[model samples]
Target: MQPFVDGRYNMSKGRSAEGFDSLLVSITSNTGLTGWGEMAPLGSFYSAAFAAGARAGIVEIAPHLLGEDPRALTRINRLMDTIFRGHPYIKSALDMACSDLTARAAEVPLVTMLGGQENDMADLYKVVTHGSVEEMIANARRIITEGFHRLQVKVGGKVHDDIERVAAVAGSVPKGTVIFCDANAGWTTYQARQFVDATREIDYTLEQPCVSIDDCLSVRRSLNKPMVLDESVTSLEEMLDIHRKGAADGLTLKISRLGGVTKTRQIRDIAVDLGFMITVEDTGGAEVDTAAMAHLSLSTPEERRLHAIAFHQWVTVRTATNAPPVIGSRMGIPDGPGLGIDVDLALLGTPFFETSH
Candidate 1:
């Protein structure tokens, strides 16, 4: 378990966490090569996924993955999908390991396998977890001082209070700094309207104001600022649906939520073609997951890339060496093959579950 740096990550609907349960997986081939993957759900309430369920699913699926060619990414993912239904969160780690393994086999970075490196450094955004008006402003300013111009302000509390928080933070930041008021699916359509109307003059984007697509669309209709959808967008079909309905100006692409790099890359391509601004990130994890997020973000065109998170920076543990270090507000992908970081087995402690043919 990795403790959150801020002590607790408070979000909407009473979802708060002192730490997150991170699950790491490693796959070794006959030729003595290995690939790493990780998945860390925010909490049971935040999504349909939880740590125990992911671990259980992995245990059931791992034995079947033996002897499969890691380089055959599509085939491997298909096999996993065949064995398990609906639980994309469980399949994410295995899919990531396969991608890492494939990239290492080709002696290229994972970004190369995705498309190619399009940005030298992917811009990062800081999340201002739900807090008091003063606390949110202070946290936002602190991260801004660290050179992060983009901020995701966690709202979805009382409509009036959220409006005050967003307005105060926006007022505190420097001109041109981007502010995203992310509710994390915490508001009802009525409350979303109240918040939006109150902050109508503030320059910031609204994100996932409500829990459902229908509610989000209704809110978006009245929203003047750009609206970005998260949590609610769990699949390519949902993304396409959002695009079709023009429900969101942008969407957050969480690698684990969308299964893994394989399916994520597919959705990313389609999103780009459809012209959507994207924030590429994961549910949560240490170095391994951060590496995957960075590679994918780097491969995305910079103009459309809103920002990506350095999730490793949020946790207390170090899961890998040679992990990409955040220099100011931007992070560069590591210059090594595969996910570009070496997982520290020592830090990982011991295997929770193992299988062999």
Candidate 2:
């Protein structure tokens, strides 16, 4: 397990200590080529997934994938879905490995497979985990000094305390900094309304203020600032439903949550056509997952991309060599083929489960 640089990652619903569990999956073809994938759930409470559950799901599904062609992503995903019902988190790593293998086979970067690179560099946003008013402000300032102009401040505590935290941070930050007050679905409709109503004059976007789509829509109606939905959006159908109801001005596209790059791309294309601002990222991972997020974000049109996260920067471990570097507030993808990084097998240790025909 890797430890977080910030010691603990405290969100609205759960807290992660040391760090979260990161699962690294590597697939090797009979021709002696390998592709890598990773999945890291923040915490059990944060999503409907857990590390052990993902492992169990993989054990139940890996045998069926033994002889399938890695390049046939759609068919592979369909098989996994047909055999296993709804554990997208479990299928994410396998889907990612297939994508990496396909791109490597074509001798092109993963972004090329996903509609090409629209922008080589993607802007980043730092999360200010839930903390005291003073602590949160200090974290915000520290992140700004690190050259990140976009900040996603975690709120969703007591309604009044959350209000103070967001207001204080907004006041402390320099002008032109983009602030996103993300509640992570921690509030009720009444609480969300109160928070937005109290902070109406502040210049910042409100994100996932309540638990349900109906509640979020109610909050969005009163919110003057842009509203972006996360956690609550998991499938393409949900994305369409939210868009149809005009519930959100933007959405956070988490690769793992949406299954993997395959489904994420589908949703992304539609989101682009529908004209929604997007923040492309993942649930969490070291290098492999970050690479996938970066490639997808880079392929997205710059004008519509709000920001993407360098999740590798959050952890104090190395899973791959030559991972994409974060230069100031922007990050550029590696020019190499596939996910563009070399996994350090020595660090990964022995696989808990392995199968071959």
TM-score of candidate 2 versus the correct structure, residues matched by position: 0.98
- What is the C-alpha lDDT profile of model 2 across 1-357, one tens digit per residue? 878988988987555456869988888888888898899998787878888998998899889999999999999999999999999999999999989988988899999999889876898899998989999999999998888899999988799999999999999999989999998889999999999999998999999998888899998887789999998789999999999999998999998898988999889989988999988888889889999999999898888888989989889999899797788998878768999989998998889999997
Per-residue lDDT for 119 in model 1?
Answer: 70
lDDT of 1 by residue, 1-357 (tens): 999887989997678888879999999888788999999999888878999999999999999998889898889888998988889999999999999988998899999989999978888898998889899889999988888899889999888888888889999989998888889888999999999889988989999999888899999999889999998889989999998899998989888899989999999989998999988898899899999999999999888898999999998988899887788888988878999899877877779898876
Candidate RMSDs in order: 1.0, 1.0
Tell me the whole-model lDDT of each prediction, alpha carbons only.
Answer: 0.90, 0.89
TM-scores for the candidates = 0.98, 0.98
Candidate 1 Cα deviation (angstroms), residue 145: 1.7
Query: Least lDDT summed over 10 consecutive residues: which range in candidate 2?
Result: 11-20
